[model samples]
Target: MSTTTQEAFWSGEFGKAYSDRNNWTSAQYDDFYRHEWGITKTQMNEDCLRDLPKDAKILEVGCNIGLQLRCLQEMGFTNLYGIELQHYAVEKAKEIVKNVNIIQGSGFDIPFKDSYFDVVVTNGVLIHIAPDDLPRIMSEMVRCSKKYVWGFEYFASSLVNINYRGNEGFLWKADYSKIFQENFHQLQEIYRKMYPYVSASQQGNMDYMYLLEKQ
Candidate 1:
């Protein structure tokens, strides 16, 4: 059983619905990334993960359907792993992404040893975590990573709560990279990119991607 409401919500039917909606193949996501960011998803991964060995062990938290892990696989990273809160998503991921291990798990308590992976990542996942719960999940990411922590999430200078699907307390935006650095003294921000919404009316809305190396 999930220990928190947020975890419960994500592990239940709602998360399955989200997984269904985002069931894009790696090639499909390549096109979507090009349309949304003017760069391929593989290019974005290469930008942040450059210089890492092809056999470097990588883990993605909340890897719904394993699309990002598939992207990493396409880039020649052989040792890959992912954890998803939803069991349905984990099953779906296994069906689509080969060789990578995708398991049903939670970020708050990742089922791995400390420094188990060379890089630990989350894509558009943290925004759903309540602010007070962020540290627990972030700590798990840090604990499991030997060298790097990567994240892509909605960005705002300060905490901004937004109603999601007519439900309150389900989503938020904040300076996640800044927060991570503030809490984890060992982390140093190595790279960051902000991609604003493509439409003019949503100009102010943007997503932030960041890489932090542990020293």
Candidate 2:
């Protein structure tokens, strides 16, 4: 596979298929989160982000259909922005999320100036990136955030590749928070939570969420 094969796979027909499969309303998203983690996505946000001002500028990198952004918006966060690699998801997000900026953009090349956003985030996005390219994309998140970098992703004690829809080189799990702290020493981790899946099909999987502040 090419080093950047993930970009093609996630920007083309497969990406559209994934978006259609997960095109859920805010309520549907909350229900899924409640089933998986016993709390709504909004509640998770509130737990991690209660310290942020309601008007803080937040950007979600690789925000597929902006479900997470919708959750933040529901929590009274006024300045929400999202960058999605898939054009189809961008359009769908525009249709679904009111008053939020949803744009087609890549995580490797976030089209924002340094410190443009109060917080930069990703939910379930980093796992799809190639391991060698992770630092570059994550650096973009750090470069754009004025205060915080947050992520929700699959977790493993070490890096491990997983077959995604029978496709190799498409998914991975790692101790993402540790990697972030190691790679960017200036950003200190402020919060973290781990939730093991309660849903039957994914019972063995654990999801991790973390918040890092620029110090």
Candidate 3:
């Protein structure tokens, strides 16, 4: 994730276009935002967050324009920080969510120390990474989370490839939550939800979201 060719593809032109295309009308973002942030009215009342404080330490990797962070901020949760791979997205996030820290960095090699956040989250970012690089990214996500990690990504029953805007091997769908549960001894699933593609909000993914607690 040290600015590899794949990383460059994300941090470059295609990534910028992806960021720009997320400008949706509020109604279009009703159930699911473009990148699978928890924006739907129902998602606001998630059970796993019952004990999380308003000032809980939260970090979002690949947080494009900080919309997810903004949602949390509006819900009165401060102490938000986001690290994005694209320089354009970082700048956009900083500009949009002025109070949050928006840094440009890779998820594979996070800049933070171990267990630095109350919850570390990734939104639709993992599948873009090559399978060979995914282990390190997953390790970093767990390494930085003090208690919980959340993911919302494209899903398939097995590892399956999908062309991303004519770029092959750039997108994949898999049971990422299953990978976490099996690979990390301490991690346990607290919640999992899947949105069928036929739903009103067919936001690019047969999306799945999971919450893993490091208990």
Candidate 4:
């Protein structure tokens, strides 16, 4: 399995399969949104929208099934946009959040203009991006956000190499503060313990949230 194979696997059949398994019903999403992220729809809305101005523009990367869109709307966020690569997930998101501006696109190349969004948020999306492509993806995220960018992801203490048959890949154990410091002047770091049920086998593993502001 080469880089091309990994990309093809994710963009082609794997996307459909994941979306089919995860996005087909509201209940499926409710469980995932709550337990996985440690937040209910109501809580997510409050956290994302807190201290922001009225009608703030928000862009969510990899907004699967629009769970965050619905949450934001419920909390009175009017200007909401999302970018997703999976077509099935995009369709499901559209169906779920009829009013949001959801576009089918890759995170590596966001279709939005620079400094267009007030707040950009991504949950559990960055880990899937290949390590070699991370710099471009991070640059794109920083380019689009005008005020703040927040991310929730799994990070390890050391680089992890994942090998599947002939395919070999690796993910850098992201130094949250270090990464943001390179690009943003003001940054805050928060660590959270992920629930065991989400990855029962990975017992001591944890997730982190990084909130960044462009200086």
| Candidate 2 local lDDT, 1-215, one digit each (tens) | 12278998998899999999998888899999989977788888888988889999999999888788888888899999999988889999998788998888888888899999999999999999999999998899999999999999999999999999989999999988888888999999999998898888888899988999999
- What's model 1's lDDT at 114? 98
TM-score list, all predictions: 0.96, 0.96, 0.87, 0.78
Please give, for residues 1-215, the per-residue lDDT of candidate 1 as tens digits. Answer: 58778888888888889989989977789888777766777888888788889999999999999999988898999999999988899899999899998888888899999999999999988999999999999999999999999998999999999999988888999999988999999999999988877755566688878999999
Worst 10 residues of 3 by lDDT: 41-50
Error of 4 at 206 (Å): 0.9
Clashing residue pairs, candidate 4? 1-166, 1-167
Clashes of 4: 2
lDDT ranking, best first: 2, 1, 3, 4
**Which ranges in model 1 have alpha carbons more than 4 Å from their true place?**
none
What would the TM-score be for candidate 3 when compared with the true structure? 0.87
| TM-score, cand. 1 vs. native | 0.96
Give the distance in Å from residue 106's predicted Cα in candidate 3 to where it truly belongs.
Answer: 0.8
Compare the candidates by TM-score and give the number of the best one: 2
Candidate 4's C-alpha lDDT? 0.68
Please identify which of the two predictions, 2 or 4, would achieve the higher lDDT against the true structure: 2
lDDT of 3: 0.79
